[model samples]
Target: MKRILIILFIFLLSACNDNAAVEELKEDYPEIKEVAEQFPESVQEKLAAPTVLPFEPKNVSLTYAGDMPGNPKRDILHTEFIYGDGVGVNLHVTTYHNKNTTWSSDEKTMKTVKLKDGTEALIEGDAINVKQIRWKKDGTYYSIMLIKAPKVEKEYTIDDVVRTANSMEY
Candidate 1:
């Protein structure tokens, strides 16, 4: 009985932590909160968005990409936040129901980083710019990509992407 009580306490504590994290994300990104509220609780939990972004986005949009190719029941969600028409930061956050799968990249360009929750995230890019950050948590795969844009004065760095990934609430 004592052991069961202890386990229950731990579970409740973790749930509270998750709730706090979700509240923080909602407070930090009202757009995410607004859009997420439109979905069911199950879908909302899978639709994780970053609390941090590299640039101040001029526009933000979320799209339901339907199911994954092989898995008809698994859904895909794509959220995009962009800063400029064609020349500034364009961040894409994609979430799907799957074991964490990462995009193929040259081995030389891929490295792993530990997120705040100690999840291993695969980052693919060069020394100066980060192309993508991918990680999996709670049976869901999440990816954040910096889409190539023309006439950009500055490109986001690996640190920027890492910060964004860490800010994601599962």
Candidate 2:
């Protein structure tokens, strides 16, 4: 009877630990966890979502942008997080499975940054002030862009975008 009691106690402790883990995941990835179900299982396995954002987005959307041309197995996914009204801040995140291709810019403002995990990323902006930070992990390329419309008052810095990249959870 003592062995049976010990086994029951262990099972209860493990159940509690599992619940705590789930709760922690939900806390860290509330928005992503809510929307992750919309993706197919294969995509979900490859997808990494940001645990932090520059702002609290009023709207979040995830879209499957179809497979690569000529190669039906490679997929493209896009996610957008929007804050404020018609002409406000828009953060775009895109991921695709493409091992052969990487992106770079010739703009004078372009620079490279090292992420917390030692991955290299590029940040670039055009004359119009649109900025993008891009990096690759495990043959998957990821990009985050900050689009501030003409009416928006605040200008998001490259550091903000870099922070978003650093907070990605795989």
Candidate 3:
């Protein structure tokens, strides 16, 4: 019963295209007004035009596992970069482990052309940071975790390292 009340309370706070829905329901029931009245007008404005909602980033998505690639001490934070005509850069900062510099140390000349649906990245010694552009796969979002140091590097592997973050809604 308590959980039901709480759930109803939260629903009352959510944005609505019309107030009539609540009114119609409440016309036969008056107890809902307490929960509705607690809501601030600011949140209500979202009904007209929502600025932000619970949404996963469009194209790319990261998945964090128990440990990171290459090093068990590291953790990956992943998210999909939206694939499109735009920009992105993945970052990681930690102590003890060197960021992966696989991109900077490659002797082979790297391709300069930006491939559509490719994540351009910056790499340091142990971190494989990629500036991810999104790509669609089986209707799921994904980003390549690659590394590129400024100069001097070996081959940059597509599966080097990538991490995902967590999100929750109330």
Please provide TM-scores, in order, for all candidate models, with all chains considered together: 0.61, 0.65, 0.19
Local distance difference test, per candidate? Answer: 0.65, 0.65, 0.29
Q: Show the lowest summed lDDT stretch of 10 residues, model 3.
A: 45-54
Error of 1 at 150 (Å): 3.2
Q: Which stretches of candidate 1 lie over 4 Å from their true place?
A: 1-40, 67-87, 98-109, 127-130
lDDT of 1 by residue, 104-131 (tens): 6574566888888999888755444347
- In candidate 3, residue 112 scores what lDDT? 28
Model 2 residue runs over 4 Å out of place are 1-40, 67-87, 104-110, 126-128
- In candidate 2, what are the lDDT values of residues 59-91, reduced to their tens digit? 655555655435555454443333333457777
* Cα distance off (Å), candidate 3, residue 46: 19
Worst 10 residues of 1 by lDDT: 78-87
What is the lDDT for 115 in model 2? Answer: 91
